[model samples]
Target: MTPVQPRTRLLFPLRRRATALAAVLLTACGDSSTGTGQPKSTLDQAVQAMGGAEALQAVTNEVVEASGSRQSPEQGSSISTPRHLSNFRYIRTDELDGDKLHIEHDHVTTYLSPERYQFTEVVNGASGFVDGKDTVFTPAQTSGMFTSRATAELGHTRLTSPLRVLRKALANPAIVQEEQDLEVDQHRFKVLVFREEGEPELRLLIDPETFLPAAARVLEDQPPLGDTVVEAWFSDYRDVSGVKYPYHLRITLDGVEAHAEDRERIMVNVSVPAQSYEVPASFQPPAQPVVPALADFGKRSTQLLQGLKYLTQTFFYFDQSGLPITLNELAPGVVHVVGPSHHSLLVEMKDYLVLVDTPLFYPERSEATLAAIKAKYPGKPIRYVIASHFHSDHIGGIRHFVADGGVTVLAGEPSVPFYQRAFSNPHTLVPDRLARNPVPVTVEGVKTLKVLDDGVHSVEAHRIQSIHSNDMVIVYLPKEKVLFVADLFNPNLFPSNQPAPYVWGVASGGLYDEIQRLGLDVERIAGGHGSGTGTMEVLRITGAR
Candidate 1:
């Protein structure tokens, strides 16, 4: 049995800040120093304002129903319009005493096409599950990884709940609380900082007039943005069973609104069956896949899950190790680097190599790919990396190339500034290769077409117009009669018998139009995703013309 990969958006743990504490405790009683000379800890005041410690601690279970939208900053159609899931519905139940949490999410996404997604995630103690069938915990040998991930997710949810945080502060004496005065949007706030052992510090801002928690924030490391503040603002308080609950909630990343929700209802001490958190007796989770040593990059392979549409069995565990670099030759000098979920193309030039896309979120995967490229093509350095678009999955590993030294990145004109700013942001929270050994990032903007000819090999990078993304760039290899693109068309995903107006028909049609407009000869199509290269017949079969 192979372990199923949890939904990409479902299992990401928030990055923690690694910096030392900076703010000092403003007096033991908290930072309310006025001429009146009042002495009271800020945490105590916040707890009392939310119906006191006794009422909050007595509550053992909570159920919240909310609706909102989820945004993917890197996958947006343009700089101003990001890819988002609208009409989002969320239901979360927490058994505080049992240290359990369950979440149900449903939403509709309208980017290149319209699709609906629904999934359930549950974390009980050290074990977790997805869709009640796939285990999220690895084997005992790698138990620490699961523990840290589950703990971070559980801690984040608790911090967002005013009642839970207050109960935690009252129960743990070792936890330290400090106070500071800060102003945002011309409004003064009394910020209470809570620090716990082996956990990220949380800062909760209090409204001076109402004494209620205005918002809670924590510093975290998110690549591209680097060290950023994630905040959850609470408002529209309503009383339910002698306890105050915030009906309206808004979340922001670096002061930009990312999510907003309105609670339809809130229940305390709800009767939840214990079996909800238990794993089925018949189910056994597979062991974690071990990463192969650098020397065995091309020799080792393992089975792992892939794709976001796992429920329909459209995706399943396959024999493809995301750790080992697999290169498939499409032409003489063109190689397609394939992975379970994403793919990249490497083009060998006269003196240097040009990698089509850096596909993968984490830096380690990119590092592995880079190592393999160096091994295959010994002395030739990767001089230029062409970004297909601004999506995270396509450009997440751009920093690794920059760290390779003297590498230039070519992107659509509108996305050049975004990459420039993202590359310059501080990565102190989780330092990658670029952060450890600092180097300047060079980005060139391509408005329409940029050609690179080494006298022997000629590659044309063209900015194409598409509904999927305005910044999409497709690489054309005239000599080899091959084209490289991302998202616009995935041959493996489209069925030959399927009708017109395919899920990706609009974007694929746009790609076809672009090829014809440029009057370039294209025989094969390579993608930033899928397993193999496709032919022009794939487009014609899908009625892309």
Candidate 2:
């Protein structure tokens, strides 16, 4: 798998520019002691911003009932189908006990405990007892419990709520205004802006009438998957206790939509004993760990002598924007490599080229990579596209490329038919450009086939066994002694000097077995994501020697 885009670090800028600007502005507007037209101080504003102490204290528990779907741009299996949807309900109960507060959730929940000083989790199905003092769970299910809790907290928020919407803006520190005028819900109100670490800043669009957030926008340095903006809309505000909460929330991540809900009822002042957050007796975590094989390759079908350039690929993710973008690159000439989700390679054989993987549907990087490839190698035209697998990031840009008259697409045999059926369906997740001009594909079969027989630098192709995907192919260059493969390996960890097998290739030993079976001479190897080039010693370290 390709490495996720690194989160941009905004600490220095925040401390240097944002904080200084806020301080300077505060100082300039000071001495308005009467509090007449002046905005409240930061502390006072923080208190008032949260609806005052009375409102905050009014609610003790919140149970919400909602049903929605979770769609992953990484998930290509559910494209044009309802299978992408996962219906669920969420419940959260925050019990304040004196200075210590214990929060619990009916579903899997992630939170920072009162006593532990660290975050913990409570999984659903299995019962957990929490003492109003410190929340605890059985050691057996610790991983699952904590994962559930954290996922709930983060996933539960609707991008639409006033608080959440504002929180999104405040995530950035660039904007200094306490409030600025913005329009939302057919009304004009003062919205706040702040700069966060990376690409874009956070914006809070509040309702002028109630000071509630009607919507929020996050800005990133790059655009979203489709080279568009991202926005979260918070709606269905209902007062739970004294706190106003938006029941329905919709988030357009680069353009993909995700939703969540709170079910049951909101509880206020319903005190609980300090011993409820304790470990349950029935909890038992299994002693054995489930380690997935990463390097399992089945067989060799074909090789692309030219497709080995992009073997070492790295991706960076830019989010919280209207159109979040992820960036990565492919080695030149190494065309048509496939992997699982977000793990694919598309190399344009000619001087000017196009890459298939835009980083898990983060199109900004994809576009950048294309432009960079073209700019770096002047006079080359990227007129061909290929997918390594059926996952979203691998093939999401097919329409974009195809619309540009890119010809001669190559993909897994299984993928060709799947795409043929998908191209004709309603394109709700993304637009369908493959339907415009049927993409010509050279699906790999049982035997190996060479794409180009250039005597000086020939490209070889092969079909390999991959546990991650059934119809996967690998490209090789006999002359260059380089291999362009996907999902089977990542060369990035080479610089870190990490141990062999690297979790990915070792997990799927089939690739190693096939390499040995075919007995192809290879000195260097590249991957679809992560590291691009590395010596064969990396795989040999995992017992292949």
Q: In lDDT terms, which candidate is top?
A: 1
lDDT of 2 by residue, 154-270 (tens): 322322334433333334334335553544333554456654332134455555444556566653111112222345666666666556666666654334454444333544555
Which candidate should be chosen as best, given TM-score against the real structure?
1
Following a full C-alpha superposition, what root-mean-square deviation does model 1 have from the true structure?
8.5
Cα miss at 209, model 2 (Å)? 39
Runs off by more than 4 Å, candidate 1: 1-38, 111-119, 132-156, 281-322, 497-502
Q: Provide the lDDT at 228 for model 2.
A: 27
lDDT of 1: 0.67
TM-scores for all candidates?
Answer: 0.82, 0.43
> Over 4 Å off in model 2, which ranges?
1-61, 64-317, 320-358, 421-450, 454-457, 494-505, 543-545
For candidate 2, the 10 contiguous residues with the lowest summed lDDT are 294-303
